[model samples]
Target: MPFLLNLLLATAAQAPADYTEPDHWLCYPGREDICTEDLSATVIEADGETSVVDFPTARDPEVDCFYVYPTVSGDPSPMSDLEADETEEGVTRTQFAPFRTVCRTFAPVYRQVSIQGLRQLFAGSNKGINPAMAYGDVAAAFAYYLENENDGRPFVLVGHSQGTNILTSLIAREIDGKPVQERMLSAMLIGFNVAVDESGDRGSFKNLAPCKDERETGCVISYVSFKSDAPPPQDARFGRPAEEGTEVLCTNPGDLGGSGPAALDAILPAAAYGTSGRPPAPWVKGQEIKTPFVKVPGLISGSCMKEDGASFLLISVDADPDDPRTDDIGGEVQVAGTILRSWGLHLHDVGLAQGDLIGLVESQAAAYRAKD
Candidate 1:
């Protein structure tokens, strides 16, 4: 098993960390770090043919991406300080680094609740998790970025799971009605539930709404992915509204503003995502792909599923036994042999739609530049 699969949380101690310190940032314009690694991918067609795709970092990207990663910290403390580790780098490599193709990536290392803390939270025992401290660090980092790096350039906000939770709080309080909202391309909140009120209005944010169209600016795109076969349960951890008569927002990134069953352009790591503990059974029967990433174009499809007061991105794997390529993918949170169906495909939410997301961002960037 990999280190990421072993960790459920992380956190900080000692004096509060300073955001102005270069060490606190995971990636910025000129810094050479984990985010600067190669992001090239190999495209595996359904017929067992393969090709490589290069994702060159932009010398001068038009927009910036302010990313906050999901909880992968292995710290034992209640709250984590500004010390970054391989865990942070590893998650960013799989999630945030891919966006270098369209924008200058800006990632921050904030004090977050530790994986140990999450164990307690999941166990219904809030012993030592400090979410406020985590949010404070991220909030300060965003402020510092705005004051120091943002030169009136448009930017995108990206987060997953715990990061999404933190970003939701930030958006509700700071960005929703503020002047800075205008400069945002969109907020991609994955692997978490974003609530909307009984009236079907934006309960999460008063001013900013969910992104309905591809080029829609200053909006949000949020969803918790679930396997189509295993829909979220009544007491599922995600994909269900927080309050009665309310609904959790679900927007399919692959086919925004359209109806059922959109082909998912899933760009995942050549290796499996946290579950199976190995690389995918060679995409082609006898061929090997050397690229760090893999694009299985039509192996997956998704739709916005809303029924029984639960809303989520219903992912369906189009498994064809006769095809020479592998048909199975991995993302579930399993314990021993038990698959946590409620978690669904939470682990691969961002990775599965990485290509479609980049496309959407590019479209929004072009649209934003056209108006400017």
Candidate 2:
């Protein structure tokens, strides 16, 4: 009779039969028309200077990266269409494409619960939107990739926000404790709280523990970033250590240990800010007209700790007054006219520590290869 469970049951009862079909995928290997190489981003310096940065695309990649994107749909409907839209494109360009420097990327577009659906769910109106429907599509797509394209190779699983929710479930149901778990390099479930006990085991996942060190393979790395001085709100969606003996897993990408602050390798969309050097409106299409991504190194630092029963990654930045690199990276999440501070830096969860995440993946890939 739990609210979420009831809603999920309702959604399953009404889901269409074709919901799990793979032909409707937005990104797959069969689609030769889609572009998946020569990924690039524009770099913005603290002094208002700009330059181009390109990621390496491998021809015979040793590892594969299966990614599920966060909630980027603005459609009023409960579920998003399978086609690739501008929002999806923007997310991929900023979040997933950069991984091309390491593994061959494979992203799947599912009928994810839309922005409106998320609002409704948080507002206590499930409206028969079952996240399982979305998970089904992801599961099918992942299975297809594993059987057809993976060829028994080691792979990494990446997801953000809603995508994280789907991937978490997928790992629990499909990957955990199975033969495929041996080939898993790592799972980057960002922008979401993954619960664990004091010993770093027992919640969210049965065998997969938090990544204790950077090169730790087959482990999970998850965190929600917030301002260094800001504590997560009591009602925050993420970082809430729900049970009496539980702690929301917080593995700072900048510093794996719950130790001192470390510098961030910030990557963002060039269009995030306008020509006038002001933060623009959401989906302001024109702000970053030419650049697909913008990298600002040494711009931020973060650390992980527990505050008021909530665990989170606290971020900090020292902006030079004379520098034009702009301190704002746009990672806040606002709901119902109120910004959720405890959710930490929801917007830039992946970008804030992109370099560290990529580095971790590369190391894990090498480790896995060595063991194989």
Candidate 3:
């Protein structure tokens, strides 16, 4: 008994908690930092024509979107600070900004495990402090949001990569099977693995199921995009079922099992560049654009398939061979160069399917409202 007590004390000492509630976040109502208005973008048509697409600047939205960003923190520490940085701002502008058209946006700044810490976790050395701290902050921020701002309205949960990890746990712990589950329109958990049984029962979630169709409410829309020809690594971060005889959930944003090729819509950063800045023609390096966001249509197509014992969204571009804009979009990572093939389009998971996800959310929101 003495030895067990000593061991518990040692473990507790190693796992020190150093997280604080986020005093400032991106999604606070009536805050100057809230980015839900005047989202203008430059649209480049296939015929070399350019136009501006201005989104609806609605403030009193009927629904809400709660977003959690990926692991873009370059902080040398194990956990990131709650304050927003350039990486956070860039991700919000490029990824979450477009969703404002559908619902009011709320993003909490959590002390996520840093990139370095994630690497260490993946290496199987450090066990729990980083993720525990990150999730602690996320939970606190979420509780505060629900109690102070939710007002019993419906909401959509959005997350990517590490953010997905936190939301998956959050749903399992707090939302699934609870009364709040009815209020969940959908969860778009991209760039991460969500497992399910052979019968499609819960793996990571209890009551929530993978979205089988576009208009399915209270379900999950998730996938890791990869080129059709590229197979994921055996050690890929997503798409592997957690237990034997089960399959990872893969819902193709395009054609959600019922139709023709989905018309792809994309919103990219103003500083967007192809792999190593060698993208095909119309997309030139350092090209100036008029808007903070760039919208490209008919540039990509997607499907869901199983490969290398993992499920993934297969992305294919229909760019004309003669068109300079036909360059293949590559995944972005912190590797400082072209992302490795094994990564399998990790970076473009959100960008490539942004349009499909938005459409899904819109449809799901309507379906949820219809239930009332």
Candidate 4:
């Protein structure tokens, strides 16, 4: 039985060649000239296939942006990569330096609210989140862009789950009080509990109010979703009521609202590799299948995608805590903020829902008209 287990492990070990380079545009810290292969591939043969795909339409040149995505626990490659480069003599060994990872695996979850405890979520080295660590790379990529690219153009910030947790603190630290607020578009924080506390400010839009009018700027467009009307647990402030009169804002760029379920049914291509050697399995009775990238939501009011502009777009993609995906993902809010109460989907695939993801970005981006 031990030998069988070892064999299974061997089969599960992913080949380095099998790992696709993460896309630069999608990377958090900006790699302005960097590019990766098309992530939309459908099949992988043992024999190689090399096909240069078409260039995607360029993203808005006027917009400056930043993003931060945190990786869950037990995954090490996102923080460190061992690579060999050739020099004059032969192969040279090089190691990348460590980046910040907050909230170690054993960190405590709170029963009540406090800012100090929340800030701990962004400190330390081995912030423990297991099964996968995709968000850290996302956050790092965005941080890089904010610091390097973006020549002071207004920007947006979006995150889900751990990504949201990391960015929430980032807003408090980096962009919240700085002069950068003038160029800011909006911050759409999705899954996490983002309250203003008793101390309020003109910039802090955490008071459950919607961005109702077109002229409204610098407000947060945040929400937490639930299947039933019942409020989610204490950790999340998103799923609560929309302060009356305010609509549950949306922007469906895919133009699918009247089209119905068929429009939402694009089949997402399977990612070639996960933390484990095997790619994620097909959507079974209990598994969450990745939705394909077709048309996503555009910037429009009362749609899944929000069209109006703000300085940042913060998102919190909710997941199931009891599920194995949340096991390595340590934080008090990780367990308390799960929106997927009944679905048994992998947390990793939740971020890739095409209609939801693209719609969210495009809708936010579309809101800002170019300043003369």
Candidate closest to the true structure, highest lDDT: 1
Candidates 1 and 3, the one with greater lDDT: 1
Cα-based TM-score, every candidate: 0.92, 0.86, 0.86, 0.43
Model 4 Cα shift for residue 179 (angstroms): 2.2
Whose TM-score is greatest here?
A: 1
Ranking by lDDT: 1, 2, 3, 4
Model 4 scores a TM of: 0.43
The CA lDDT at 72 in model 1 is 79
lDDT of 3 by residue, 263-310 (tens): 567665555432322232335333557676566678777777766687
Off by over 4 Å in 1: 1-16, 198-200, 274-280
Clashing pairs in 1: 8-115, 9-114, 9-115, 10-114, 10-115, 11-79, 11-80, 12-79, 12-80, 12-81
lDDT score for residue 235 of model 2:
70
Q: 1-372 in candidate 2: lDDT tens per residue?
A: 123323544556234324245545444543441236445666666555667777766577788888899888777787777776877766776788778778877887777788788778778777657676787778877887887788889899999988887788789889989989988988999987677888766588888988878767888999887776567777777788656788878888877764888887777665541221223232222234366666776667888877888788888876677765556556566554555665667777888888888888888887887785
lDDT of 4: 0.31
TM match of model 2 to true structure: 0.86
Question: Mind giving the per-residue lDDT tens digits that candidate 4 earns over 1-372?
Answer: 011112223332222221133332322233322121232322211122222222242343444334332222221232222221121001000000000011000011111111222233335322321112232333344454556555666665654434455555556656666776655666555444344322222222332233433333444544433322222333233332223323233222223232121222122233321232223333222334232211112111111321221111122222333322211111112233443332112232223233343343344445655333
Question: Which TM-score value belongs to model 1?
Answer: 0.92
lDDT winner between candidates 1 and 2: 1
lDDT of 4 at 69: 29
> After aligning candidate 3 to the native by TM-score, how far in Å is the CA of 193 from where it should be?
0.3
